[model samples]
Target: MAASSTTLTLRERWTRFVDEEMSTFVFSTGVYAAAICAKEYKELQPTPQRMQQALRKTGAKMPLITLSCAIGIAGMKMCILGVSRLREDYTRSSVLVACPVAGALLRAHRGPRAMAIGALSFGALGYGSDYLFSMWHRRNADAEEVRYALSLREHHNVHHNDAFFIETLQSNAYLLEASQK
Candidate 1:
């Protein structure tokens, strides 16, 4: 009876930890989405030149962003490991949680019913965990690297311009063909 109680206590603690971590992950993803939206909004504003200049200076913020990404990745890895262990130890409950969570993490888009359920479930479980983990890792390792990454993102955005895309496509084709053996 004592052993059983200890086991139950351990399981409860694990569940609580998972729940908290998952919540943090979700929050981080929401932040990332918000950041992306803000970038888009800045691009659309009348004073986009200032925004563009700021983006060009993003190299200064690289460390923060990189650390965050690293943390997010680590968190996701931990979540996967925890879920796998839980599934092996407690098949039914783990299935109930892990299946949907795994599906969502993978962004699986199968049939309508499965997709809808998986998306909603995974959205809830996987949340922004990955993003947060990665971001945290990047921030800790190289604060300045984030600025460069942001600049890269900005450059990529400009690549979406029709003229730029056309030019890039032509150039890429030439390079690819030229490099062929």
Candidate 2:
């Protein structure tokens, strides 16, 4: 009986891992496509014809919106998988990224000065809330899937803000490398 139970557990874990990885891939790709479309739309300038064109382009392009939605769904799935696996490292990293982004958004919506203070305050609060909620959900629920999904949602929020950071980091690294030459 014990051996059979162990085999079942192992099988379950494997399945979950596979599902999560698939989800991560889809989510990442979708977000990338969506971001590209958004940037393109923004660059076109706001006119009735341009707006209609943008909408048509996005709607007609299967690869664009479909990829984004797939990515989002996949991310949520991966989060659930992580939580179920009790992977604290992944969860913590996710929280780190999510908290600051949430704060920044809150700040941005409030204007310049409020943006700074709001970012700090909201970021801390967001992180704390995430931690507490994760803990609570883990204890109270049969599965931590919902908690994991929420974490992934937080991660998506951070992902949206990551473009500037990524670009800056790449530029700085290039400059440093050039200086050393």
Candidate 3:
């Protein structure tokens, strides 16, 4: 019972993993979409034939692009979480490299246009996740933290502005700093 209490169950861990993956799907898909859109709509006015070609290409590439995006988001989340521990996050860094590397690979097998999708996604999602999580922490008060640590650990749905997020992040940082002492 003691051991079980200390470690997360498989279901809990899987749920957390799934939560992170789903939260960032929009950014990942956006990355894929941007590249696909750009490639598909390069010309000022596209013909019906051109539209069909672009749709076909973009559709075929979406799976790989989405996979790469999901990979990137997970890597980014791991890096941020590791940073919270006040140590080097080598694992996150390594995992994150997969995003661009996969993109480059897509470029090799697909086209330059396909590569853009991955690269864009890496930039958009990688950089954007910091903001996404900051937004999450901002909305939840210290009460939320207490509930999660002592009670059920679930994400809060309420949201606040950037200022709130910054203030909460600062307060959390202070708490962390004090804890280290």
For all candidates, the clash counts are 36, 4, 0
Estimate, for each residue in 66-161, the C-alpha lDDT of model 1 and write its tens digit: 445445445455565687685556433443344345444333323457546755766555446655665666554443344444455467776447
Off by over 4 Å in 3: 1-3, 42-46, 87-181
Top lDDT model: 3
For model 1 the TM-score comes to 0.28
TM-score of 2: 0.27
Could you give the C-alpha RMSD of every candidate to the true structure, in order shown?
20.0, 22.8, 14.0
List pairs with backbone clashes in candidate 2: 26-71, 27-71, 30-67, 30-68
Q: Give model 1's clash tally.
A: 36
How well does candidate 1 score on lDDT at residue 55? Answer: 56
lDDT per residue for candidate 2 within 60-131, as digits (tens), equals: 664544543454344445544456466555655665554444444433433667556755775678678878
The superposed Cα distance between candidate 1 and the true structure at residue 72, in angstroms, equals: 0.7
Which of candidates 2 and 3 reaches a greater lDDT? 3
Which of the two, 2 or 3, has more TM-score?
Answer: 3
Alpha carbon lDDT of residue 21, candidate 2? 64
Computed on alpha carbons, the lDDT of every model, listed in order, comes to: 0.53, 0.55, 0.60
